[model samples]
Target chain A: MNSRVVISNIVRWVLLFFVQVFLLRNIGFYNLSAPFIYVLFVLALPFGIPNLLLYILAFGTGIVMDAFYDTLGVHATACAVLAFVRISFISVTVNRDGFDEPEPSLSGMGFKWFVLYSLLCIFFHHLVVFFLEAFRLNEIGYTLVRCLLSCIFTLFLVLLAQFIFYKRKSR
Target chain B: MRNLWIFLNRYNAFFFLIIFFVAGIILTVRNNAYQRSVTLNSTNGLVGAAYEHLNVVKRYLNLGMVNDSLAKENALLKTEILALRSIDSAKDVTVKDTLRNVQYTYLPAKVIKNSFTLRNNIITINKGRLDGIEPDMAVISPQQGVIGLVRDVSDHLATIRSLLHKDTRISVAIKKNNALGSLIWGDRNFDIRKAFVTDIPNHVKMSVGDTIVTSGAGEFPIGVPVGRVRKTNVSTGDNFLAAEITLFNDFSNLQYVYVIKNKYAAEQKALELNSKNDE
Candidate 1:
């Protein structure tokens, strides 16, 4: 709700977008590797964020990515799907009271719980994204490989971001 | 209407998701040539600028390799020049066959930007209309391998519709038998494959490593190397053969390229137009 929080979120999104577009995009392990790190933007949003607002932010972020990468609507589609599923994912994992927390800070949740949550969200985002982008069942084996590799890279980056930014305050 | 708006607001994320999903499907399905051209135009500008800057760095890094390639080309050209001079002095009428057959002109230009991660891949060249590069000009590397065709040209920059693009289809033929086929991207595993060859004699033997070349049916010239046959398998319910071609040009590492201009292109086009009118 604070202006500082809003500014930080915007800055983080921009930095992630640059990294995704310029740096990570060129780091394909092979032909089948594509890491969708942009999902971290949605994953890091506050827990009680409005569903409509989340979806809009996710879509707008994706459009910026698409504009840079020249993919017309693929990122928008994937980001929207990820944002829409975030609520259900949170409900299934965390208790109702925990879900009402101010923000989805990694410090509030223990390290293991945070890792699991981030992993689930990243996996779901990459699966839908890579599958839809490929749009074929014939290469299921290849798509699966891509999904696994992307998830690994995305998980590493997402956790790194959370650990570096969300420092635990001493009680 | 009030209830509808309330319900929509309640599940607005789901509704937006549906809308975006539909939009993606529509883009995939109705990927018409014009839609592709427009997409290429939009991305070409951004990708071109980025690639141009990257090219500067890459050019410096790969200076040795580029010089090697350029030197090899220059030596070949000098040899041809000497041969032409010798033929001019000796009045051998059959020396016409010994003259270098310059079917296409090569213009040295760097790739300012390239995009392979996208569905519709494009590459921007430093040479443009000012350098005599025009739309539909066949761009190739020094190895005579097909890179792409010039799609759009400006004063000092040109956009190439790279061979990796989904909408790109070039008429190609097997070198041995001259069997015509369509070279297309399968979009599976980012491989460029050929399909739609309907009528090849069963007796014509196709072996692995057989070269594939441009069919010269369109703007492209014959003998422009496309790829080598990686695998050839017979299609079910169709007599045609499906060949997986491993493209000769390493598109990811493209640096300097030549834009080809066919001297007889206008004449050939006019003849084809008149024939169509007669028909």
Candidate 2:
């Protein structure tokens, strides 16, 4: 990867961490729901990034968030699972679009596909995080409702950012 | 080897995911209170919670002079209260309140770490051998209510098997009739501080609000408040009564507790052991 791309990625990482811990941490519906738009950084990586590197990056992001939130390992575990899913997701869906080199973003992938991918990734991450934190068989229903609201909120924020940042692409 | 490497490469991501996923899981679950109560005797936390609590302990240690003075004052007040209670008991003709000798001495200790969520919850107290605390010593709340007993000891720390532990069975008796039973934390919910007193004969009448007290069993002293009875029923197998009691001290917010060391415990234990050996 070029120095420019690496610098941008690093910048995105720090920016997302700061935003997640500071701005978005408290912005939730009631006390239970919050958007984790920092997931955008993971979702925006190049489609061809190494699987091993992705896991490491996800773990690092999660650890930083865990430190800030004091949730310890919750975010890191969720991010690692998300990174694992993203690998297969990109390979099967985005790579088939005939682009020589692809970035996993709204402009790079078509609108419908990007929406579906973001929804799936955010839903999976939120569901894992909420259920893992609850960890009780009786609280499964409560955790499901919490996971669903947080997933939709996070996906909405991620898509909004994509629309604002990315320029119009040829159909 | 070349073919093996190629085949391995084909499934490398899945295998790697399994490894990293396990690592990630350990990171998350290990720090959580639910996992700590099951695995450790409040012995461990992730590196961060450990360090964060180390600072808290350091601050608590610095309050030594104040705590010492307060404890001394409390001991004096307790002796006065015990004398006053004896005088009051003489006035009541029907009530039979027992008086205890000063055989068990109390040592003040702060709970450095605690968990109430798991089946076998353990509490780490700041007192150990150096502080005259030993395994099997009864732990009581500030109000002289039963909490649990010391299980394991290190040089400067001890783990108390809280009343919430599944295996804990402190011998107790109903306040109304000195009928014997043992207190067991049979409930799955830790949030509700409750326990069951089992093995009392079906003939012993028990009500919902009856007080239960320690029967001066193997380790615990007599008359320490166990809990108040909540419900009663008989299991199908036996004709004995099972009385659920709501514990007095909230285990969730426990901070400081008194460890009671029995002066005559060694002699009592030896006599009991000799009897068993003879039998």
Candidate 3:
């Protein structure tokens, strides 16, 4: 609720949006590669934020991306789905007491736990995204390749962002 | 009402999530209609502007390659002009000669984005409705080979359904024998098959290197090369020989293309429609 927290959230969203649109848009490694750093916006939200608010914010983030990429509603669909699943993911991975905090940091959750958590979330987001983008089951193999490659790239970017932003003292 | 408000507030995220998912489903179902909606497309004015800027940056990066293509095409055009002038000097040319020398116009445009790896590939070109380009216009490379046809046209951009697309079918024929056939993609590799040509006399001596050209029966002009025969085999069920043709123009490396605007297209279409009605 503090002004500093609000400012930091705004700054993070802006930075992620720029990285996604301007830098990552054309950075396809092969024809099927996808850079999905936009998920960082969802992952960085405070743990105790209302589920409803998180979903709204996630949906909004997706709409902004969809607008830039001209991908119709694919991004929004995937982001919203990921946001809805985040509560279950956090509850399963972290303790209820730990989930009551104002911020979700990799440091707070410890290194190995945060890596697994971020990787799982990234995998879910990428899987849903590639499937929706493909809109078919005929080329399941190709879709899997896309999902894996995108998930790996997204996880790398997410972890890098977490390492740079969240200080050791936050743990 | 107080309880309802509290419950709604508690589930507000879920409510929005459901609404957004429903919207996505509706958009997917009505994709065709949504694609044609000017308002929804134009609403992303900032995004569109950003893409336009990115296009400019990309154009600079691709300048050298584009200039090379332009120079090569210019040389071809020069030779064509000289040939035309020589033919004109011989004023005793017959009506048949004039028809044979019919020249097609070419429009130069950049391929902003192309989707060849997908099943139903659509290419976005920089030229569009404002540039006298319209839907159904046949696009070809500078070498006078078939590329695809324009499917949709906005003010500044047009999407071409590439020949590599599974759903794309072009009226093509054997250039040597004038045998009519349809050029269709196998939907796997760049390989295409010319189907429904069962009646070509076996004596015509079909070979792997035989050239295939547009039949001029449809929107495409005559003499525009489609591809060269890659493989030939007779159908098991029918007497028709299916020939796999390798496309000369690579859809992946497409940079500049020409949009053929037939002056007599409207008249030809109307006459064909009338004949169909009579039948």
Give model 3's docking category: incorrect
lDDT of 3 at A7: 94
Interface RMSD of 3: 4.5
User: How many steric overlaps are in each model, in order?
Assistant: 3, 0, 1
Tens digits of lDDT, candidate 1, B176-215: 8898877776555464333223344455678788988888
RMSD of each: 22.4, 17.6, 20.6
Supply candidate 3's per-residue lDDT for A102.
Answer: 69
Docking class of 2: acceptable
lDDT of 2 by residue, A22-114 (tens): 899878787568789888999887766777888888878888887887777888888887887777677677544566555777776678989
The sequence of per-residue lDDT tens digits that candidate 3 reaches over residues B37-93 is 543666687688999999999999999887868755874684466346434444556
The lDDT per prediction is 0.73, 0.80, 0.75
Clashes of 3: 1
Looking at model 1, residue A57 earns an lDDT score of: 86
**Candidate 2 off by > 4 Å:** A96-98, A168-171, B38-279
Q: Rank order by TM-score, top first?
A: 2, 3, 1
